[model samples]
Target: METRFLKWAEILDFLILIGSSVTLVAWIFGVPLFYHADGPVLSIFTSISLLVIVSLRLATRHFQLWPFTANLAFLMIVGGGNISSILMLLSAPAVHINPKSTLVMTSISTSIGLIFFSFYEILLYLRRTPNRFWILDDILIHLALVPGGLSLIGHIFQNPNYLSMSIDPRVGISLLEMAFMALLALSTVLSNPNLFLWKFLKSGTANQLIFVGLFVNQYIAPIIYLVLMHDDWKSGDFGPELFIFFGGVIATLGFLLFQAKLEENNSLIRSGIN
Candidate 1:
């Protein structure tokens, strides 16, 4: 019964993730009723994604592979992405359409969420990993703060007009963010020089395929952002930002899979010796 319940829970979580992804894609592509001003579809999708992420964290609590504190820190990073999106959506009317004091407040809250989450990811990378990629991750995480923190401060000082002048600064900061991810991808590939060879020599397993997906997404996100920043740097285009944020998700999942493979290899070696 317990196993069956767990299976059902997993299915539900998968469905929720799929639903959120679909809605987000639709919003990005300007699907009918998705990019509208009034509906709460984006908010609902973000909220459900956050809940699913939280549940995954809880389910992994007993695994004991890494420090719970580190996992919590990672979860906080994930939560930051969700909260920032919701806050931006809620505050959109105030800044662009309606301009209400309450909406300004919501925007401020969202900025804070971004700040906290960005720092949390940095802190976790520094505390948990001794790999060369760790240093790059830490620096990039800090670099991400420049635009985000400034945006928050801009909101506080100018209220509804905060996001108005934030575009150039954000674009500059995101350039650094992209560079950081590029470094991460390079470091990973260099560290595991055989990663690609292994996948090619053997039929790519599910996990290996996921790793490839992550690598591609990481690089693709930064490149796309660079292009968008060049073309639409004036209006605070969020398309690239959203892509980079999800790129971070892909990077995290890839790191987790790499760790699992390392553990599995170690276990196999130990069993052979025994």
Candidate 2:
């Protein structure tokens, strides 16, 4: 599952670029579908940032084609991050359909995360040993996920507080921004087998169990629950907390069953070895 997914990173990057580009076009032409009627507008700068970030990834993937590709990509990543930081500190708003719109804190943080990843990619291009950087890679990717994950949960629960890192409610992240950032970080991490995350997904029973549990709990089970319970949820049969509780129950039960099977297999292997 991991290998197959990672192999498509370049393709995924293109898809993301296309999606972000659509959002840009929508913003330029005042398309209602791209922005919330009652919420913050997706900043044009944000869309442009998405394009640049993904383009940098694609460029790094083929750095050998151009001798300056890595250097240029690294400079752009660092430059973008620095510019975002300056804007963040100044409390300046990014260019958007709404003139009052401010940059979401997650956008700034995501730039920083990418800067680190770009640096790592540079080292890889230089043919450095990857084993020494696994821990750093894991830390950086998880840190990158924090804001994006929070924004996603915020959207799911209809909570504005999770949508931004600022005290000002006007500053919020769009769903597209969060989605792209999360997918980019995850795909980039998985694309490199030497990363701790990829290594964990491929080996021991315990590691596999954790990966399965997280996948089910965070993704599959919630999606199933949401689809099946949409009518009830829409009619106010239960709250978000209840939805989360039941989804977690389903994930936990599935995880326990898988755990039992894994333990049985391990025991058989031990006996055979003995």
Candidate 3:
């Protein structure tokens, strides 16, 4: 019965992802969409829902893996960021806050979450397999977190404007994060090109599609941020934010996909027994 529920949950997640993608595309294409002042509140609710779904899936599937705990920790950190965003939104006046400041805060919370998750993942990965690639990935993830963490701390301290007047500190930090992501992509490609390609090809079709979807969703925002960094930072461009919104939507979908995958895999195992 649990397995059956997870399977249905996964399908629900896919539908959610599809819906989010459509909404984001519409917004990006200038569909004249307006969000409520409680946008972040809605986002937090979504994040919590995703977290619950993911937790259920993981508990049902890979509860025995040592790294599962680390993964759960990472999820919690991501959820915390979502919660923080909700708090910020609620605290601000009903009117729209300055986009630049909002962007900075959002980036800061995301960086903090990513850094914590990366460190935890690295530690868990190393415990399981002490490999050069893992070490490299760990270093890259840590390095990426540094700039954003520093910038966030600076903001908290109310640092006066610095020499780089035009460039928002968040943009610089985001660039570093993107560089790290590029390294991660390289590492994944180099470690097992066939497996990577196979995963991509299988993503939409395979039971493991949830993992693939999650992987893709996680990277999209950073990739978009990287592209936009080359442009003017102060222009209040909506491109990166749109990408981020989509990322959130994708994450929610991923939770559902994971739940479904667990049920499908379990069913196959049981069928083989028969």
Candidate 4:
């Protein structure tokens, strides 16, 4: 029964992705939103990128085409592509998608990626499904993201200033990334799931190397961009929402990790006593 429900939930997620792609394509066709003025390609590529991620997920259920790295690559493509989009909106003279629309894209894309990530863990990795913990991800998607995403889609169609907005105000959320894999992939996989990567990476040094690389690329690189190099910072604009979002996520993740560790230690104690 639990497996049955997950299937339906996955289908709904796919449908939402499809609907969003269709809407985004239509909007771009009507009013092209380019990543660069000299190069008008990214607008179209966004939809293509979305399709590719979905297709990859469908094609590899058994970890056939490389289990660990595949999804990370997909996320890199998605995150790397969309990360700069917020900055485009924050730049002066307002040359990118409207702040309202940008906010929508941020919420939708992040929410979708997180939903997929959580589902992958719940359905494939976790031993228990449909637990009380599942409600956390559900709240993120249903309560906050879905409504905002729907509103953005509706607003894009009606606004005359569709791709135009004032970047004159120095206030906009900087995009921030948090990669648990970089921080604790080893801990997560080696927990109750007892999962591990291919044998080649199971060795101590190799895993450490990968962890360091991912930490630098996924966590450190983005922090540098958001803080020092981003246009928003250069323009003296800063929105506290993204910081709040980042903070809440990190705090929750920390608490969860602590709980998992405590549980594991308690289990070992029980086993020893028996």
Error of 1 at 59 (Å): 9.6
Say which candidate scores most in TM-score: 2
Q: lDDT tens string, model 4, 1-274?
A: 4355445534544653464466467655565332322211223333444455544544454357556556656666655565455455445324444433422333223334444443444344323323332334323322223222222222323211211223321121111111111111222233212222222134479655754454234233334444554445322233342354345444444444454455556667888953
TM-score of each: 0.27, 0.61, 0.29, 0.39
By lDDT rank, best first, the candidates go: 2, 1, 3, 4
RMSD of 1: 17.2
| Tens digit per residue, CA lDDT, model 2, 9-117 | 7777888788778877776676633555344345565566667667666776676575556555655665566466547645754332233443323344445545555
1-274, model 3: which lDDT tens digit per residue? 4355445545544444444344445444545123332222112223233334334333434456545555656555654654665465457523323534432233333434344444443343345323221233333433443333333322332332211112333222232233333333333233332222333345566636655565455445444564566454433233453456455544644454455455456667888953
Candidate 1 residue-wise lDDT at 107: 32
* Model with the higher TM-score, candidate 1 or 2: 2
lDDT, model 4, position 200: 17
Error of 4 at 232 (Å): 30
Candidate 1 residue pairs in backbone clash: none
The global Cα lDDT (0 to 1) of model 4 is 0.38
Candidate 2 colliding pairs? none
